[model samples]
Every structure is written in structure tokens, then in C-alpha cells.
Target: MARYIFVTGGVVSSLGKGLSSASLGYLLKSRGYKVKIRKLDPYLNIDPGTMNPFEHGEVFVTDDGAETDLDLGHYERFIDINLTSLDNVTTGKIYSQILEKERSGKYLGNTVQVIPHVTNQIKDFIKAKTSGYDFIICEIGGTVGDIESLPFLEAIRQFSNDIGKDKSLFVHLTLVPYLKSSEEIKTKPTQHSVKELRSLGIQPDIIVCRSEITLPKGQRKKISLFCNVNIENVIQTVDVKTIYEAPISFYKEKFDYQVLKHFNIKNKKQPNLKPWYRTKNIILNSKKEVNIFVVGKYVDLKDAYKSIDEALIHGGLANSIKVNLNKIDSEKLKKNQIKNKLKNADGILIPGGFGKRGTEGKIQCIKFARENKIPFFGICFGMQLSLIEFARNVLKLRNANSTELNKNCIPVIGLIEEWYKDGMLKKGDLKKLGGTMRLGSYECNLNEKSMVKKIYKSKKIYERHRHRYEVNIAYKNKFESKGLIFSGLSNNNKLTEIIELNSHPWFVGVQFHPEFKSRPLSPHPLFASFIKAAKNKK
Candidate 1:
């Protein structure tokens, strides 16, 4: 039987529950156990595909096209595993399944209630994803006392009994707020939070206290006594300069060892955290720094582009340079101030987003980069707009625009209503916004003597994508004749995957999201090249 560890948060949200679960999985996996992490979101959205990035960070795309919570990104980065759609479940998805079953009379006219019906479905959803893994760490979204999370909370409570105590564990993460005036880390909030969780008929096996200062010995013992957990299981995760230090910090506190002891699993091998040591050293001691300006629509919320921001940092680590990202609001940027905001910047990057909210400013910046030979990297929507800019300015298309933005104009970038998928051309219908896009990983073949081929140093690559429209392959020949090189194409050569300017310094745009695959120890090649170009420009 597969062991389960359900992680829940209390007192507040954004307490790094995802990171805690991922770190636990990392530790267990390093000790020679096959592990996978799942996210149980209580939100009503079937998936985060259509959600605003400003509200919910980046929608992490699994290899199987599941638009999961951004926490799944943390899980993938820490565990080094490519998760699938089965790993992410939401209230909307669960209710949709239940309602579908009821409508189909699969329930046999039974009144669908939250007790056995909903909870059983939740249990099955959790169990269905746990086959072939020794450990399954499930992170519950939102806080413990929220009403929306009641169903999931109840399900996990009953799930522990169904699976037996020895095969299950509940890890609770809560805040231990410091009273600055009194200069003490009060444990009352954590106590009450655990009390609330217990009221729901679930007791936490471990309490991870998130605070600014490390917990004192007396406070740990006090928390253990109050929460009815072993003192050693009360792990301290104070604020750190880098999140890569989290596992090492918890290892020093023997957090994973306590988890092993609770599950009665004797580790056959010790953990190998040497890679993290290198990450820490490079992140802290990189003497040379490069400035990269990120012009995007959602500048107010940094989480809106969390993965992109982290990828740049990873790229910096790969090149032994510290990357300083200056986030500029594209919608608010004036044409005259483009140089002012981007002056002395080594490179400029435009990340992906939906709608036509800030296309004009993006085009202006792209024009600046192309005309002045500044290093530029454009992502999904970024890639689309780059083509539009080239068509209007260089190719003289005059009224160039995407069908997604203007359907009646020159459509250099058009919707992918009918495209090849798995080597077959299929008619597409994406009237709804949710899970209808061409998502997940796809194969791309690089052209010989192309910039991307030189960077990747390979003839073919597989990258993850999450876009509804694609560049018009019909104009591939004409565009290439005009010096706008189609550097990368799909496996079937039906879609353009990458574009580059032969005459510019380092101008490239990609249809896939390479940020999802970037790592701290080994950044994505495109990002490393982009940063290298930016550093050289400096």
C-alpha cells in the first residue's frame, strides 16, 4: 500500500505549504523512495487555466495538459518529476465528476450528499493518483477554518482512518507570529489552529511553524505539549534569503527524519543535497550582475510571473551572474519613456499573457530591441506580438495583428482552429476558455545553422506549451524571404515553434514556455543564452 501524507495550512494562507510538501518529498526521494506530490485545491475553478495570473500565480502546465496550481511548479522543481493531470484535483473537477455521474444515473437515483458520496469521490481521486509511488504528499489549498475547504478537510479526516494510521500522516503548517513589543514567538495562533483542525476530527501529526525567527527550545516544547505532537516534529522554517535553503534548514532540524520515524520507515540511504549547496553558493556569491527589464501587463503582482522570474535567476546561476529583474508595467509605459525605463538594461524580456491589454507597448519595446540590437526574448503571447511587429514594420503588412486581437486585419498570428495533434490534423473548437487550448509538451525540430539549434546544440527538442493560437505557417516562406527566420518548427512542420532575426544581436521568441523546465542547478538553455547575451551587452 502507498503511504499518504496530507498537508494542510492554518491561521493564514501563503505559508509555503506547497514548499513544505515538496521539501518533504525531496527528502524522501533522496533517501531512495519513489514519491509524487498532488495538489487538492478547494476553489470552484475546474482548473486554473482561465484564472487571472494576477490573482493566482502562473498556471503550471503538466505534461498531460492539466492547468494546475502554481504550487505544482514548486513540486516539480523540488522533486525533479514531471507531474501529470492526475496529480491535481480541485473542488470544481470533483463536483463536475459527481454531477456527471448523477446525471448519468450512475448513482442509481441516490441523493448525492457531502457525506459518503462527495467524500468517497475525493478519496478515490486521491487514491487514483497514488499507484506506483511509495509516498504521495497531498497539499490542501486554503486555510483549515475556511468554509469552502470543509469538504476536503472532512475527506482527509476520514481518509486517514480508511488507509490506517501507520500508512498516513497529516502535516499542519501555521504561522508562529512574533510579538515584537514583548519579543516572544507566541504559540497561541498555532494552538487554536490545531484546535480548529481537531474539531474537524483530524489531528496533525506534525506542526511546521513558519516565522521570522527560529523557535526557542522552550517554545518548541510548549507547542508540542499543546498540540499533542512530539517535540521533534515541531519544525522551524524561518525566513531565508533563498528558498533553495529551505530543505537544508529543515534537515538541520531533522524534519524529514521525524517524518521517517513517524511512518516507521528506516531509510536505507542518506540524503544527497550537494546540488543545493552549489545552488546556495552561486546564488549568494555571484559577483557579476546583469540587469534585465521585464515589460509585462501584470507588474503590480510579482507572483503573476513567478516562474519566469525564477527562471531568470536560475539562468543567472548558470552563467555565474546575479540577475536583477526590473518589472515595468507595459500598459503604463509611454513611448518616449521606453528608453528611460530600459536604459543600460542588458536585455529585455516579454512574458506570456492573454488579451490585447498591452500589445501596443510591447510592440514599441520589440521595435526598440530590433532596431537598436538589444537582446530580446519573447515568450508565448510575446512571440505572437513579435511576428506582428515584424510584419507591420519590416515586411510592410501595414495592418498586422493577431486574429485573437483583430480578426479582420492582417493576421500574421492567427487562431489554431485546426491544427495537427499527435501527427493528425483535427478540427478544433475552443469556444470555452478553460482546458481547450493546445497544452502540455510537444516536439519541435530545429533548423540547421539556426540560432536556436546553436543554443540547444541539438536537432530536436520537446518543450511545454499553453497557447490557443499559433503563428501562421502559411506565410512561412514569405516571412523567411524577408529575413524573419523560422528557426524552429513542429515535428510535422505544421506550426512554427521558434522565430529569430538573422541581423539582430539575440532576438528570439518561442511558442513554448521554457520557464517551466528551468532549474536552479541547470537553467534552460534558452534562458542561459538570453542571459549570456544580456551580460555580454552589459
Candidate 2:
């Protein structure tokens, strides 16, 4: 049986509950215990697939085609685990399942209520498929006291009671605001947050305080006394220069020690943190720097491309180089400004996004990178745009664009009508906007002589994807005649997966998202190779 640790936030959102859960999972894993981390989102949306980037950040795609919260990316990167659709649950998903069950008469015409039906479903979701792990760390999304999170709170409250107190724990994260004017740290919000949690019948076993400065022993003791937690269990997590330092920082504060003590497990061996220390040192002491421009529609909000941003950093970590990312807003870019704006960029990256918001500008950026011999890497939508750029400039197709943006064009990129997922032939639906894409992981076979093959050193690889359109295979020969190599194809040899310019220095576009698999300790091969090429460009 796996022990449970429910992580909840208080006072405000974005307090790094996901990071805290991931850090703890990493610590336990280092201690040679099997662990898994899950995110229980309170949003009513079935998934984040249809949500706007500004509204919900990136929609992370798991291997099993679940478009989940971006925090799953944090969890995967920190713990180095590949999660599944079962790992993420949302209110919308829960309610929809229950309504389906009721419609199917699974409840036998009983009144479908929140207490047993909803709470039981939530509990079943948590405990399902969790037999082999030693610990299951679940991070509850949204802050406490929100009406949407009420049932989830109640479910967890009941969950603790049913599972016995010895096997369940709650960790509450709250902000410890530092008022510079008064030069005093306030603990009332944390106290009130705990009070709110206790009102819901969930007394937190530990309180993780997020503060700008270290909490003095006096404040720690005060928080312990007011929140009714042990003084030693009141852990402080000060802001660090890099998020990679989180596990190490938490370990320094004995956060993991307190957690183990609560479980009454007697393991005195310390976690092996040399990899984290080395990564931190490299981040702080790298001498060589490469400026990579991330041209995208969501440049205004860095979180919109959270995984890509972190993957580039992971690339730099693998090469002992400092990556300076220049986020360029594609909407504001003009054709004439491309050269001057990217003159100093050693490499250029275009991340995946939907709609035709700033696509013309992205095409211009790709053209500049290709013509100037700069290291260029493209992903998903980026790959489609690269195909369009090649079709227009090289093949003399005057009007080339994706069918998603324009109905009448060269159709360099168009909707993939059908694809195989889990051995089922899934068809694309024009009416649905949610969960209707060629998603999850798929296999691609690499051409033996391709640059990507050299980088990966493998003939076959599986990468995660979240897209509706693909490069039109009807134009493959035309593209190849113009020196654009379709270097990779799907297992059936029907879909184009990767493309490269035979004459260019380092230009590669992939239809699948390699950024999803990049980690700090072991960077994805494509990212590591891209960073190496970018460094050589300097």
C-alpha cells in the first residue's frame, strides 16, 4: 500500500505547490523508494486543451494523449517520470464521468449527489492504478476556499479518515508576506488559511511557507503555535535563483526529513543530490553563452511556453553553456525587421502554437534563419510553417499556407484526416474543439543518413504530439526536389515527421514535441544537439 501526501495551497495561487510536490517526490525517489506524483485540478474544464494560453498557460500532453495542466510538465521534469492520463484529474472530467454513469444507470436511479457520488469518484481516481508505488504525492490545483475546490477538499477530508491517519498526510503551502515599509513579516494570512483548511476538517500536518527571506526562529515558532503544527514541521522555502535548486534547498531545510519522520519510516540515509548541485553550479558558472530567439505568439507570457523555455535551459545544462532566451513576439515582427532583430541570435527556435495570429512573422523568422545558415529548430506548428516557407521560397509556390489559417492556398499544411492511436483509427472531427487532435506519443522512423538520425543515433523513436495539421504529403517530391529532405516519417511511411534542408548548416523541423521529454539530468538528444550546434555558431 502506498502512503498518501496531499499538497494544497492557501491565501493565493501560484505558490509552487507543483514544485513542492515534485521536490518531495524526487527526494523520496533518491532514497530508493518508488514514487508517483499526480495533479488534481479544480478547474471545470475537462482538460486544458481548449483553454487559452494566457488563461491556463501551456497544455502539457502526456504519453497517453491527455492534455493536462502545465504543472505536469514540472512534475515530469523534476521526477524524470512519464505520467499517463490517469495521473491527471479535473472537476469537469469527474462530473462528466459521474453524469455518464448516471445516464447509463450505473447508480440504479439513485439520486446523484456530491457527497458519495462525486467524492467517491474522486477517491477512486486517486487510488486507482496505484498499487506498485511506495508513495503517491497528489497536488491539489487552485487555492483553498474556492467554491470549485470544495468537493475536492471534502473528498480528501474523507479520504484521510478512510485510509487511517498514519498513511495519509497534508502539506499546506502559504505565503509569508514581507512588508518592507514596516520591515515585518506577517503570519496572519497563513493563520487564516490554516483556519479555512481546518474549517473544512483538514488539519495540515505540515505548513510550507513561501517567503522572500528566511523565516526567523521566532516567526517559525509563531506560525507553529498559531497553525497548530510542530515548529520543526513549519518548513520555509525562500525564492531561489533557479528552480532546479528547489529539492536541494528543501533538503537543506530538512523538509524531507520531517516528512519521513511523520510517516515514522526509519531511513537515515541522505539523498544523492550531486546531480542537482552540479546542474546549479553549471547554471551559475557557465562562461559561454548562446542567444536563442523564441519567436512565438505567446511571448508576452513566459508561462505560455513553459516546457520549451525549460527544455532550452536543460539543453544549456547538458553543454555547460548559458542560454539567453530572447522571446520575440511574432505579431509585432515585420518582414524588414527580421534581419536586424535576429542579427545577434546564435540560434533561432519557433515553438508550437495554434491559430494564425502571428504566423507570417514566424515564417519571416524561419526564412531568415534558413538563409543566414543559423541553427534552426522547429516543433509541431513550427514545422508546418517551415514547410510553408520552403514551399513559397524554394518551390516557387507564390501562395503557401496552412489550411487551418486559410481555406484556399497551396495547402502546404492541412488537417490530418486520420491516424492510428492505440491501434484505433481515430478520425478528426471538425465540429469538436476539445480532445480532437492527433495526440500523444507515436513512433517515427529516421532516415539513416539524416542529421536528426545522427543526433539521435537511432532508427526509431517515439515522441509526444498535440496538433491537428500536418505537412501535406502530396508535396513531398516537390519539396525534396528543392533540397528540403523529408528526413523522418511515421511508422506507416504515410505521414511526414521531420524535415531538414540538405544544403543548410543546421536546419531541422520536427512534427513531434521533443521538449516534452527533456530533463535536467538527461537532456533530450535533439535539444542537446541543437544547443551544441548553437554554441558552434558562436
Candidate 3:
């Protein structure tokens, strides 16, 4: 038996609902309770895998290969939990499953509508994934009145009543915009958002007011009276210096205490939040600093590389330094600008992306880093382009390209048509580009003398991958002949998992995303090492 906390946002999207939910989960876990955070996206996309990074942000992949919303990344980083595919759901996925079941007569030849069919499915999903967890915090995506989210909203409403009021709690997060000119924080948006939620027959057990300034005297009371929530239950979530401080800030406001009080669950033990406090101290007191320029396609949106950005921050924390991250949009960079922008940087990074846009610029940047001996790190597409750059400049393969870009040329990179698993080279189907790819955790065997192996201090390690194309294995020997070390390979020795420059200061490209595994307490080894090298260069 577990308690359910349904967290929904209003006024507008991108209000840190995910962060708040994860922080609450962290607070709960600190109190000796098992906690799991889930994201219920209202998007019609089956998963964010096929979506553009500029639009939907990073498609966080679980260890089980489920492409989920970026909010799951926040949940994972904060709660330190390895979430599963079952932890995330979307309108597209739910509808796809329902249609499949309908076609198979799982609905018993009845007309399947959104009311009972969709709502029941949603309830079933929530209950199914809650097994063995003491607390499940589900953050519903989108605003309260979005047409796409109505089914999910109604589903949770019915669930709260059906499961009894004591078993579930609803937390509504809405904005209370501050008018600097008027010197007041308005609560009309919060009032209306709650009224809309009430129209759906779901009254929030707790109302979290998001504000830029402090909640003025009598504002909580006014919000409580108008929103129909108790004054003590109206919690103010103010902006913090760092997101890692959110759990502690909310704790100061007694957010979790109110939640537990609502549930009437006696405190079993006090929460140990020293880990968060310690990390915050490091961030606040770091004396040293280094600049790490990240050149990427989706540089316009920081969310596109949220994990990468955070990983770099964690790397700085590990080294007791401040990481100054500069985002340069590769699409707009000229040849001279690449050198101009990167000349002062201690480190350079190119993250994962799709398509051919800005690739030449990315290649130019990689070449500059390679020749300058700047500590460089490349991920997925970044790794692939490095090979192309190496082949063209080092191996004299001027026409080298990936099949994903040019299907007919000399393919240094090509689609992963098949993989050897369970003692078999299974044939692949490339008909769909949905959630299908070499995703999640896969073992990579490291060469004993490689720099990557030294950093990881392990001969065999597993990292999560998210790519449709891979470095062609046929060109391994030719690439290795040119001092392009295939430092790490898959368990079958057929897929290239890691690449490195043997003579450079610190140059490494990985097919898998190490950023996905980085944490605040213990940063990813690759990033921590990369930042250390950057510190050395500075």
C-alpha cells in the first residue's frame, strides 16, 4: 500500500513542477521512505525519441530503453532512482496501446470512448507502477485546462475518490506573478487555475504558489480563502540560487511536513538532508573556475542539453571549481568564429544531435580542438562527426560520410541494422524511427591502456546509448591504423562504443551518453576527468 501525490501545474508550463516533485520525493526518501517519481506527459508523441530536441527537450532514456520526457531526468537526478519505462506515459503511448487492444477485441467489441476506457486505463497504469513503493509522486504535464490533458485530469480525479481521500493527495502549482512596478505579487492566476481545477471536481490538498518574490503578509490567507485550501496548506515556492537547494528550501517552508500532516502519517524519523546542504556549500564556496564551450545545433534552447549542462556543473563540483559554460549555436558559426569563440576556452564539447544541419561547423570545431590539443569531449553524433573529421584529415578519405547523411557515399558511419545479443546477430527492422534504437545500458569492454579505461578504472562498464547509426565496424582497422584508437568496443567486439586520440591532450568520443549517469553527489567519471583536464589547461 502506497500513498499517491498527484502534482499538476497551471498559469503556464515550464514552472518547475518536475523539480518540485522530485525535491519532495528526495525529502521523503531522506525520511526513510521509498519514493518514486513519474511523469504523465499529455503529448501525442508515443515518446520524445522522434521529436526534435529544440521542441521537446532531451528525450531521457531509462535503463530499460523507454524514451521519456525530460522531466524524468530531473526526477532521476534528484531522487537518485533508476526509473523504468513504466515510470513514464504519454497520450500517444496510451492511445497506441488502447488501439492495439481494441483491434485485438480486448474491449469486447464495445465502442471505446475516453470516459471509462481511457480513464480506467490511466488508473490501471498508476496502480500497476506503484507496487513496493512507499510513495509515488506523479507530475502531470501541461496546464490545467489543456484539451489534451483532460483525460488524464479526469482520470486522477476519479482515482482520488475511488481510492479514498486518505490514500491520495493533489498538489497544484500555479504562478503568482510579481509586478515590479506595482510592488505586488498578484494571485488572480492562481485563483482562476484552482477554480478551473475545482470545476473538474478535484480540489487540491495543497496549493504551491510559484513566485519571484516572497509571499507578502495575508497573501497566503487570501489565496487559501479564494482557492478553498487551508492557509497552512498554501505553500510558497520561491526561486532559489540553485535547483539543488530546492529540497532544503521547501523543507524550511515545511512543505513535506504539511503533506505528511495531510496524510495523517506519523513521522517515523527525521529527514537527513546533509547531502543536499553539503553540495550547495560546494557550489557556493568554489574558488577556482574554467570555461567549457559547448558547440551544438540546439543551442538556442538550454533544455535541449539539460543533462549535459548539469553534468558539467557536477564535474565542477567534483573538482571544487566553477564551470563557466558557453553555448555556441553551431548552425550560425563561421570558420573564423570557431577559432575566435574557442580560442580562450579550456575545454570544448559537442553533444548528440540528428541530421546534417550545422555538421560542417561542428566538424570545423572538432578539427580546431583536435589541432589545438584542447581537452575535447564528444557524444553520439558528436562522436560520429569526429570520425568523419579524422577520416578526411588523417586517413585521406575526403568523401567520408555517414549513411544517415549520404546513403551512397563511403560510409564511415551507418545505421545499426542488427546487433548480437543472446548469442545471436539478430536482424533489425528500420521501418520505424520511434523508440527503436541501441538504447539504455550496454556493456563496453575497454582497452587496458586507453585513457577512458584509466578514467573509469574498469575494464568493463555499461553506459546508456541513444542512436540509430553507429561507427561502421569494417573501417575499424583502417581507423586504428591512423592512431584513431577504438578504445572501447561492445561485448561482441562488433560495435564501436568509444573512440579516442592517443596523442592529444584529452580527446575522447563516446557512442553512449555518460551525462545521463552523472549525479550531484558523485559526478560521472568522464566529465569529472574532462573538467580536471580543463583545469590543468587553464
Q: TM-score per candidate, in order?
A: 0.95, 0.96, 0.95
Cα lDDT of model 1 by residue, 1-538, tens digit: 6889999999999999988888888888999899978999999999998889889978998888788899888888888888999899899999999999999999999889999998999899889857788988889999999999999999998999988999999999999999999998899999999999999999999999999998999999999999999898899899889889877887887888988899897876878899888888778887899999999999899688888998998888888888988998999989999988788788999999888898899999999998989999999999889999999998899898887888777767766653333332344533342234788998899999898999999999999999887787777877899888999998768688999999988999999999999877668999999999999997
What Cα-based lDDT does every candidate model obtain? 0.88, 0.91, 0.89
Q: Candidate 1: lDDT of 247?
A: 77
Model 3: per-residue Cα lDDT over 1-538, one tens digit each: 7999999999999899999999899889888889978889899989888899889888898888888898888988888889989999999989999999999999999999999999988888888857798888989999999999999999999999998999899999999999999888899999999999999999998999989989975899899999999998999889888899999889988888998998898896877788788878777777788999999989888799999999999999888888889999899999988777887899999999989899999999999999999999999999999999999999999999987888766778876553223332244633342234788888899999998989999999999989888787778889888788999998778788999998898999999999998888779999999999999997
Give Cα distance to truth, residue 443, candidate 3, Å: 1.2
Error of 1 at 377 (Å): 0.7
Instruction: Kindly provide the TM-score of model 2 when superposed on the true structure, using C-alpha atoms.
Output: 0.96
Q: How far is each candidate from the true structure, as Cα RMSD in Å?
A: 3.1, 3.4, 3.1
Best by TM-score: 2
| Clashing residue pair totals per candidate (backbone < 3 A) | 0, 0, 0
Model 3 reaches what TM-score against the true structure?
0.95
Deviation (Å) of 181 in candidate 2: 0.9
